[model samples]
Target: MPTPKAPVRGRFAPTPSGRLHLGNASTALLAWLQIRSAGGTMLLRMEDLDRARCKPAYSASLIEDMHWLGLDWDEGPDVGGEYGPYVQSERGAFYREAILRLQRDGWLYSCYCSRAELLLMANAPHGLEQEGNPRRCGCLYLSPEEQETRAEEKTPSLHFAMPDREIFFADGVAGARSFPSAGDFAVQRADGIIGYQLAVVVDDIAMGVTDVFRGWDLLDSTPRQLALFDALGAEPPRYAHGPLWLGEDGKRLSKRHGSVALSELREQGVASERIVGLIAWATGLIPEPEPCKPQDLIGQWTPGRIAQEAIVLPGNWMDRLR
Candidate 1:
């Protein structure tokens, strides 16, 4: 007899660097739909590790925006669950444990590369697995004494020595994908902040997340996280890279684009249902942009319906949503 599949456990981890925006809401709705359609548990995780920008006020507003949009989670920083501490900033012990294990197993090396050195290298490798942050480091070969000397000058960061093998995976939206060995990438910064690659993987493994449904912009991050999962001896989650939302300026949405900010929209008197409908229409889930609740989209959610290209919001998109 064949074994039964485990229930789907999906998650949406939002950073609190800024107010929630339309693009953020659309992604959250899609993630919620994926879990709800499959009778799975949805979880909310606060990616608030960056102390310089992420603020409690932003997180609170994000929670309020989610509530206004009719989205809820079984576990989150607000609603306690088995996963107790849902904020990444409070989960340092888990990341430190993984880093120590990686060090003991000799899978990690200390990097002392400087940004100025990176700027001088015209041939830095193309991919850093992070959008807008292309980087490559080669200090993995430094001798112990050389590293010791460098450590005396500057506190070094830990970089995972990528295993010399290709990674292959099937994405639900982007189709089959492969990546060659990327050079050493950081797992911890010199200032003791855990890197995104390490923290996200550790969180998913600990939370028992079965499916990672998020924007396609993060497609490149999978191989790096998969490698981390391999080193940590934990099973990685199934991934689906959905279409990324872009602004009228042909750039990915961010906090700077205030027109689509959810809080601004609320203050301007835009109904939550209009936002949901516009999201549904933009995602190709509905032929007409009609006002409805988040639950209305759950029953109709299908991976095939999402556009393969990035969805662009027009400069006057508010008029349509209005």
Candidate 2:
């Protein structure tokens, strides 16, 4: 972690592919609170990289939901700051430049594997960094003749060459962590879209983000992002992955959890304060599930206070708000 005096720039980036569910809103509240309590700059970014699935309507609705929950940001798509184009789809030029620089440094290579071939290659043995660690894809490293033939056939995905070394970083919430080096990963897909791994790192670096607070589900992805940050020669933000809100059945809380979406809650005339208050209580931010706003919890925000274990909420957890 940087010195306490260092400027803290944090962001809440949400993909505009779906409605903001309780899980999403709760995470956002935690992220907003973490940054706000530190008196840091908080940014909202629309991670609409997959343009085909992400819609402007969803983005607008998400902003509305956040506003309803009393969350505010200093920089975002609505309120432009130094980082003008906060939406991922508009940041292709930056990603392309990074790709060029990586290619020049021989840190990127072409991947021509088709969908079926890629699926079969999933089980292919990887160069292990340690026993029982997660493994990513190995480099294709095709010869000149094979490359020429593939170029004529289709556009190849540009993949970052993973350096065979362990990546270790301290998480503000999860504590000391380490991930074994695995296989190469794509920076750009064959369909001509900027890959998630590359875009996330590039966006955070460009926005001068100093802290990253997200859900526990994305904890494993930190190393891959850290690797990209290193390859791109940028200082990575400190990451903190908060516990997830899972269903009572021990599965991730998702669309299957009926009427838990912020939009649905609003449609049912549920007060935003009620939702925020219940989340604050469930996540161990408050002793009681009393009505409150995002700002109300900022004063009591603490890394230790956020629930550590996956919070298993029952199917009718939304009833409390009603």
Q: How far is candidate 1 from the true structure (C-alpha RMSD, Å)?
A: 4.4
Candidate 2 whole-model C-alpha lDDT, 0 to 1: 0.85
Worst 10 residues of 2 by lDDT: 130-139
Shift in Å, residue 307, candidate 1: 1.6
lDDT of 2 by residue, 1-322 (tens): 1222349989999999988988899889999998999999999999999988999999999999999989999999999977758999999998999999999998888887776776766676655453433333433557888888988987888888777788899998889999877557788999889999999998898888999999999998898899899988988999999889888788876777677788888889999999999989988899988999888888889888888798888767766776
CA error at residue 165 for candidate 1, angstroms: 2.1
Clashing pairs in 2: none
Please write out the lDDT profile of model 1 over residues 1-322, one tens digit for every residue.
1211448999989999998887788889988999999999889999988999999999999999999999999989999878748999999998999999999998898889875764565365564464432344657779988988999999988889877777999887778899876556779988988899999998988888999888787888899999899999988888987788898788988755557788888888989999999999998899999999999988899888887789887777778876
Top-scoring candidate (lDDT): 2
User: For each candidate, what is the lDDT?
Assistant: 0.85, 0.85
